[model samples]
Target: MRVLTILLCLLLTGTPARAVQPDEVLPDAALEQRARDISAELRCLVCQNESIDDSDAPLARDLRLLVRERLVAGDGDREVTDFIVARYGEFVLLRPVFGLHTALLWLGPVIVLAFGAVALVRGARRRRQEAGTPALTPEEKARLDAILGQD
Candidate 1:
């Protein structure tokens, strides 16, 4: 049983998944650096939370290649980004532009936090008001006293 468990664990954990090959790397260090920089800022559309540089998706590799190609073609960083934005809207950027279209993306978290603070303050105030109210009538107080007296 122990050998079977070990075999199962090895089967699950030991196999190496396919990743990008070393031969696919760019020969130019400067282009490679530019690719890395651009990839770091670009969101991987397939893996929404990860940057293109860190994502293993084929689309991420394509984006990396695109950035490198643009850099090699004498385009500046902004030009490369502009090209991508033109192709895939502003949503592809990790830090979206500030405009009517993207204002909510920039402000959504702040608005939620402000609302939460207001709600929390109101709740605490309500609790305090309830706590400060008179505890009991004379009869209720007498019953409470009697109950305590027994203890």
Candidate 2:
């Protein structure tokens, strides 16, 4: 039981294996670190939600290589990111930039919610108004009562 517990603990506590292969590692520690930071910000196109740093997909590997290449070519972090964004479109970044182009993406849900709330309030008010007043006129009420043999 103790051996099993120890194995379980090791398994749970072990650091996750990185997807970057040994051949892909940069010689310069600083550049490698920057590449890692950039990779973490980039979405793996094939893996959807996973960052390129964590993804094991072939596209993720290619993206990692591209980042290293850009860094070696003396591109600044922003420039590297922009290059990727230009090639893959805005979806390459895990967090999209807030700008005129993306304003609708950021605000669309709130706008939809506001419209839904207005429609809901209007519908409730209409239902309440409909339910509050009786439809029968005095003559209609009298006729209904006479048909039911009520004096």
Candidate 3:
């Protein structure tokens, strides 16, 4: 039982294996680290949600190679990222930059939440108004009392 528990813990805590191939590693450690960093920020177009560094897709591999190639050719981190963004139209970034064009993306949820809260408040007030009982006139009250007395 102890062995089973230990094995289960080990399996659960194990680090995820990177998808980078042996041949794709750069000869320079600095360049390789930079390449790794850049790949980590890039989303795999084929896999949709997975980072290029963690995706095993062919397009992910190609993008990894492109980052390394750009790094080797003396391009800075920003330059490599910009080049890729230009080609892929910003969808390739794991986290997109906020700008005027992406204002809706950033503020849409807040706007929806505000509208929902207002509607909820209005609905509650409306229900309260509708639930109130109207006051009976003196004549109606007398009639009701007379009917009860007859019963």
Candidate 4:
């Protein structure tokens, strides 16, 4: 039991649990560099926030391979990117294209900030109005004064 426990610990120690993407062995350094550049601009669909080059997902590996293949096949950078974009939509690009469909993506945060600002202004105005109003009525104040035996 002690030996099994020691073996298990040794096996599990310092080994990365995340699966690594397949390394593309490019014939030319320049082609590999281009592939890396393009991959860096592509977002991994499985890991939405991570670039395809950085993600360990199987899908990311496939996309990385696809990019390298296209590069080796003499496709220009723009052509390779366009091919992926056409296949996966603008979501594949780390920075999406500006178009009617993506207007919301570009404007969403600004719209939210504007709405929050309006809400804050309205809330502040409401608070000011409430603060200016007397908490107790004149009659109530008078009653309280009388009850307390004060003028």
Per-residue lDDT of candidate 2, residues 34-110 (tens digit): 99999999999998989999999999999999999999999999999999999999999999999999999999999
**Whole-model lDDT for model 1 versus the true structure?**
0.82
- Enumerate clash totals for all models, in the order shown: 0, 0, 0, 0
Candidate 4 structure, TM-score to reference: 0.68
Write down the TM-score for model 3.
0.80
Which pairs clash inside model 2? none
What is the C-alpha lDDT profile of model 4 across 22-137, one tens digit per residue?
Answer: 45658698988898889889999998988888888889889989998899899999999999999998889999888899899999999999999999999999999988958988
Error of 4 at 46 (Å): 2.5
Give the candidate order by descending lDDT: 2, 3, 4, 1
Off by over 4 Å in 1: 1-21, 133-151
What TM-score does candidate 2 reach? 0.70
| Deviation (Å) of 45 in candidate 3 | 0.6
User: RMSD in angstroms, all models?
Assistant: 6.8, 5.5, 4.7, 6.3
Sum up the clashes in candidate 4.
Answer: 0
Clashing pairs in 3: none
Please write out the lDDT profile of model 3 over residues 49-104, one tens digit for every residue. Answer: 89999999999999999999999999999999999999998889998899998889
lDDT of 1 at 79: 98
Q: How high is the lDDT of residue 140 in model 3?
A: 89
Candidate with top lDDT is 2
lDDT score at residue 134, model 3, on the 0-100 scale:
78
What TM-score goes with each of the models? Answer: 0.69, 0.70, 0.80, 0.68
lDDT for each residue of candidate 1 in 1-151, tens digit (9 for 90 to 100): 9999999999988854423346546788877777678878898889877888777899977887787788889999999999998998887999888999878888999999999999999999999998896869988888988989953
